[model samples]
Structure formats: structure tokens, C-alpha cells
Target: MTDKAGIHPKYFEYCYVAFVAFLLLSNIAATKLIEVPTPWTNLVFDGGAILFPLTYILGDVLTEVYGLARARKTIITGFALSILASLTFWLVQLAPPAADWHNQEAFEAVLGFVPRIVAASLGGFVVGQLLNSVVLARMKQRWGEKNMWTRLIGSTLVGEGADSLVFCTIAYYGIITGGTFLNYLIVGWAYKVAVEVVLLPLTYAVIGAIKRAEPAYSPQAWAQREAVRAAR
Candidate 1:
């Protein structure tokens, strides 16, 4: 049978692996809040903020090159793996330490999974990633393949906005003041979007390379090919 929709790309597995790695690492890093000294002022943000944006970039690449179905699968896989990681960490925290182990407190401080934070992370991830993929797919359908920047930026704005708002509110509502929480939301959202914008050229190069290297998976591209085949 002919491969329709290019569902299985040559490099899809690699992308999936990278996506999951970024997601898991981001979750681990998010446990800490780091302060960055800037020329203008000190910036306080979660440690994950530095690397989490890469997931969105990867998400964009997945949706843009491999189509929404594949992107959705990757997103769901990442979500599941993240949950598994959290559960494993929680279990580890519960397990008794050896008598010689002197760093149990530090280990717990670093790896313990707080229920509220875990919920926030999972909830925000699902909402943000689903929205990101859906928006990019719909926008591609509406706009065709002409404007990559529009969809990337537009989707990131909405997707990251939802993610930041949900995560910050849920994770820090009681721990930090409302104002500070809002700042976190805004800063995180802006930083993520900015990361995508700054990396647009690299994104373009990667997408272009993937498109050239793989069979067409995008709905529009596949439909167009099918139409031509039918005409002949």
C-alpha cells in the first residue's frame, strides 16, 4: 500500500526522542527558581524557563514538518513520559535511604514532586501543546504554506500565553503574591515567544531540510498530491 499522508517520516523517531528529552529535562529543571542578573534588573524565573522554550520550538518543527497527527502523538507521548518521570521521582522520594546516605534531604529537595506543581506542569503542558499544534495546523490550512512566521508567532503567542498563565497561577498562587505570579506569567510567556522568534532562521532551515528529506505529511501538501494523482 502506498504511504498516504507521509505519516512515517525517516527521521520522526529522532524528533520524538529530542522532544521527550527536552520535556523531561525541563520538568526536572523547573523545580528551582533562578535569579539572573541583567543590566537593567535582576530577572527571577524558573530554571526550566531557560530550556523549556526549546520544547515549543521543537513542537513547531514537529507540526510544521510532520503534520498535526504526528505532532499530537509526540505531544501525548511527552505528556505521558513526563507523568511517569514525576511518579518515579515521587516514589524515589518515598523510598527509604541507606544509613550511610547523608544527602536524603538534598535529594528530596531537588527531586520531590509536589502534587500541586506536578498538576500545574501536566495541565499546562497538555493545554499549551495541544493548542500549539491545533493552532499551527489550522493556521496552515487557512494561510496555506506561504507565511511560516505568522503561524509560528501567532501560535506561540496563544500557546505560551496559556501555558504560562496556567502554570504560574497553579504553581505559585499561594507561594507568591498575585502580582509576582502575574509577572512570572508575563515574563515566561514573553521569553518563550522571544526564543522562537530569535530562532526563526534556524527553524526555517530545519523545516526546509526536513521537507526536502522526507515525504510530504502536511494535509495541504498531501491533498494537493492526491488531487494531481486523481487528475491523471
Candidate 2:
């Protein structure tokens, strides 16, 4: 890879948009918990569990393609937006409803996130995403851009592990038993890692396509472009 100095600041805006979208949508979906019945037992998880893992995948893509600084900016952007959304929801819930608005209760039920839950969500997201980006960025520096699968899996394990543990503990500390909370954490982490594993092929393709389409900030690509410029 080339030096960071050579890489330009042109960002792939779509990735940032997708990252924020996934983050916000997951938080919205987390308001509900659903059960998945299996042969031996039922697997219970928050609705966000189904979608939250995608954020990590996108985080990986952002770091891998655009470098750590850009990924950090994207992560902070998502985090700020999530807090804004939560505050907006809270304010709307607190506002007086119109005379004919009988559905305020329903609306609050769907959108009114508790303060503890909001804290857990925001804290988990920032810590997990930063860890993910830092780990992958460091691993890429160590491994020289090879073995993407290893980096992805390893980083997700650490990142999702922290995310699940923090979010579950804070969000459901008294609501669920300790054993159940432990199960939730374990299952959530496993499910997230599994999603990334199953989607490895698709992730690879997307990463490759994005790298080809937007090679502006990639250090190695930047070096090549500069070499060609020198030759010209």
C-alpha cells in the first residue's frame, strides 16, 4: 500500500449513506423482539439482530476501501445521526397530541425508546464500530491486504462481541434473567458473525467492485496512478 499522503479525500458517498441507513434502521427495528422456533428450542432475538450485522459489513468495506480516517468519520456520522433520531423521537413523543389523535399510545409504543435503551444503542454502536474499523485497519497494515476473509471474520468477532454484550446488558438488564441475557449475547454475536460469513462471497464482490469503481483514496491505487503520472 502507498502512503496516506498520496491518497485523496474523495469519499464514496453511497457507502456512507448505506452505513447510516443500516444503523438507523437497525435501531428502529430493535424496539421489538421476535422468536425463531427451531427443532430443539426457540431462538429469541431483538428484531434489530436481523439487520444490525450489516452495519459491520459496511464498516469493513468503508475501512478496507477508504482507509481508517474516512471510516472513522463515517462511523461518527452514523453515531451522531442515531442520537439525533433518538432525540427527535423522544421530543415527538413528549409533544402534545391533537384532539383526534387516539393513536399516540400506539405511536409511542412503536417509536418511544427508553433513555437506557437509547444510551445502550448509541454506546454499543460507537464502541463496536470504532473497534471494528481499528482492528481491520491494523490487520490490513499487518497482512498487506491479503486474507480479507480472516480479517473480516476476526474483526467481526471482536466488534460484534462487544456490541452484543453491551447492548444486551444495558437494554435488558432487569427485563430478562441473567441466563437469558447471556444467551442473548451469545446468540446475537454468533448470528452476526454467521451473517458475515454466509455473505462473504457477496461482500467480496461488492468490495472488489467498489474498489474498482472508486479507487481514489486507496493507497496502493493512488501510488499506481502517481507512478503513471510520473512516467507521463
Candidate 3:
């Protein structure tokens, strides 16, 4: 269902749903920390870091095919649903546990969103994702299909940089400081960008499929859009 004249995407709903699902699940996973030992220093990050990069990839997919306006809408939708999930957990945490229910503590431990964490998650997501979309969209307009790889990597660098700084600073600045803080920030950012780069082939496949599947998507269509944007 669409009101637009030249746009009706077949697979966008799937992408949108997957984007929101990953966003929520990653937040849950972030509650758990991952540590691996090495001679130099242990690799440390919240579990969500493993899965969170997919959201940005999805953001790229959305912007690459659907446009930035749609990508921003999806980002906001994810933010709203995340808030709802957080509030729901807080409410359930407040409820008294049944005598038979022995897992309240576990539930709180895994599902709880402290104020700092909540602020960090929501703030970082909005800022990083919007930046990703905007940067990617602008790059696409300039290079079209000629520099797709550069567009993806360049956007990830800017977006992931902002996300790592905002999320770590708000969530762990005071508690973790000095060299350890720097490690967390650098490792988190590097890990995310590396993952996306590793998965570049898959991203290309997904984008190509969606571009072909969308009835209104074509190189000429996009070029016209670029012309329209320039005129405005």
C-alpha cells in the first residue's frame, strides 16, 4: 500500500521488521558482557555489539533502495519500540513475583534497562543511524552506482564512530575510565566496522535483490531523483 506515484516496494516490510527485531534483540544482548583473553588485553564488549552492526547494514539497505526519508522513519520506529519494550520490562520488574516463579532476579538481570543504559541505547541509535542514512544517501546521489563500496564503508565509519562514542560515554564513562575506557571505545568501533566490511558481499546481494524487486527502482529513476534534489 502506497500513495506515491512511482514507488511501491515489495520487500521493504521484511527489511523494516528485521531491522526492528535486531534492534530489540541487540539491546537485550547488550546486558551481557563478552570478554576474551589475549596477551595484550582482553577483548571486552557488551554482547549486543556482536549483533548491533546488522541494524546499520539494514539502515544502509533501506537508504540505498528506499531513500533516506524511509530509513529515518524506520530508525524512529525502532527507537519507539525499544522504549516500549524497556517500559514493559520496568513494569514487569515492579510486579511481585509468584512463589513458584524463581527467576525474577534472573529476568531483571538480563532484561533490565537502567536509566543510563536506556539513555545510551536510544540516544546512540538515533544519532548514529540518522547519520548513517544521511551520509549514505548523499553519497549515492553523487556517485550513483559507481562508488557503492565507498559509500557503504564511508557511512559506516562516520556512523559507527558516533555510536561508539555516544553509547560508551553515556553508559560507562564514569564507571570505566582511563586506558580501559579507550580500549572499549576503540575496540567497539573497530569491531563493528570490521564486521560490516566482512559482510560486504552479503550486503551487496541484498541491495541488488531489493533494487531489482522494487517495481519503481531503476538507475534512471534514481538519477531523476538526484536531479530533483539538486534543483531544490
Candidate 4:
């Protein structure tokens, strides 16, 4: 019964809470459209993309600070939570609007969940996140955990590509033909990856700071070690 990481077990619980919150919020926020003054008017994106990239930052933190297994587990937890949220939202949308509600139409318009979209989202997330975690863990091992930039960006290339392509194709393929789907795919991929690129310095700072604050071979580490072992 040696203490893993020489710290309390509760921190792992806290990390899981943070991970779930970031993920759920990202999904909810993605539905809302907020216009920003980008160079291109047609290339609009939802607010959720802004926050969604932070999950990668979190991914980096999880792998760098706790190692790969814990990070992968967190990703899986996020995947399940995302699916649950989509299913719950779809159920909510199926219920008829009350006559007394003034904003029923508006609510449905914003909060509605389409099954195909949900499936695409869930599928893309699972594949992209799994790829991200695997690449990150292996990169960390190969690179001695020093080059944070290389790992974060490199993993995003694979993860974001999978996410953008799967989501865009599954969600909008037949609906948007020819160049439109391609544009959407490109925009989504670029926007998401750009967010990660911009956040690199901040990610490094946060990961470094968190690693410094954590203890070694405590419950969190043991839990994380177990996760990595399972993934391998």
C-alpha cells in the first residue's frame, strides 16, 4: 500500500472533473454561432471550436504530467460523456414543444440534435482522440518529454484531420456537394488546428506548472500508470 506519487488520491478525481467539464462545455457551445471578424466572411465557425482546442491542451497536460494511460482514460471518459450528452439532447428535442412556451422554436433551432450529426461527432471524436493520445504518448516516450510543441502540434495534425474529415463528411456530405464540403472541411480543420497552435506557449506553461505542483507515485500516478499499461 505504498502511496503512489506520495500525494492524496483526490487529485485524480479533480482532474477527471476538469476533463469532463471541458468536454461537455465544448459540445454545448459548438451549436451556437458567433460571428468574429476574420479575414474571410464565408468561413464562419461556432464558439465551441474556440474552447474545444483546450481539450488538446488538456490532453498534453494529462500525458506530460500524469503520462499516457491517464490521458487516454480521460479521452475515453470524454467520449462516453459526449455520446451521453448527444443522446440526451436528441431525446429532449423529440419532446413536443409546449403551447405556452414562447421560445420553443428558438430553443429547438439552437438546441436540436440530429442523429447523423451526433453519430458523426461521436465517431470522429473517438478516432481523433484515440489517435491523439497514442501519438502523444509515443512521441513523449521517443522525445524524452521535452519537446512539448512538436508533440502537441504533431498529434493535432492527425487528430484534427480525422475529426474534421469524419465530422464534415458524415454530417454534411450529401447536403453540401462539390467545393462546399471541401471548404467546410478545410475551415474546420484549420480553425481547430490554429487554436492549438496559438495556445502552444500557454499549454507549455500550464503543463510545466501543473507538473511542478504534483507529487510522485501517489494514487494519481498509480492510476495513470495502470491506464498506460492497459493501453499498451
**Best-performing candidate as measured by lDDT:** 3
TM-scores of the models, in the order given:
0.89, 0.89, 0.90, 0.80
Q: Identify the superior model by lDDT, candidate 2 or candidate 3.
A: 3
Clashing pairs in 1: none
Q: lDDT at 50 for candidate 2?
A: 72
> Which ranking of candidates, highest lDDT first?
3, 2, 1, 4
Candidate 2, residues 152-207, lDDT tens digits: the string is 98999889988888898888778887666777777888999999999989899988
Tens-digit lDDT track of model 3 for 70-94: 8888999999998888888889989
Poorest lDDT segment (10 consecutive residues) of candidate 2: 1-10
In the range 51-169, model 4's lDDT, one tens digit per residue, is: 67777677767777776677777888888877787778778777886788777667676667345555776788778877888888899889885787899999999998998788777
Against the true structure, candidate 4 has what lDDT? 0.73
Which window of 10 residues has the lowest lDDT sum in candidate 3? Answer: 1-10
Q: Which segments of candidate 2 are over 4 A away from where they belong?
A: 1-11, 217-221, 224-232
Weakest 10 consecutive residues of candidate 1 by summed lDDT: 1-10
lDDT of 1 by residue, 1-232 (tens): 1235334577778888999998888887887876677797556678788788988988999898877988998988988887788788888888999999999899887787444566787889899988999999999999888899999999999899889888887877787776666667777888889999999999999888888877665567678678878978
**Pairs clashing within candidate 2:** none
- Give the Cα lDDT of each candidate: 0.83, 0.83, 0.86, 0.73
RMSD of 4: 4.8
- Candidate 1: misplaced stretches above 4 Å? 1-7, 39-41, 114-116, 217-232
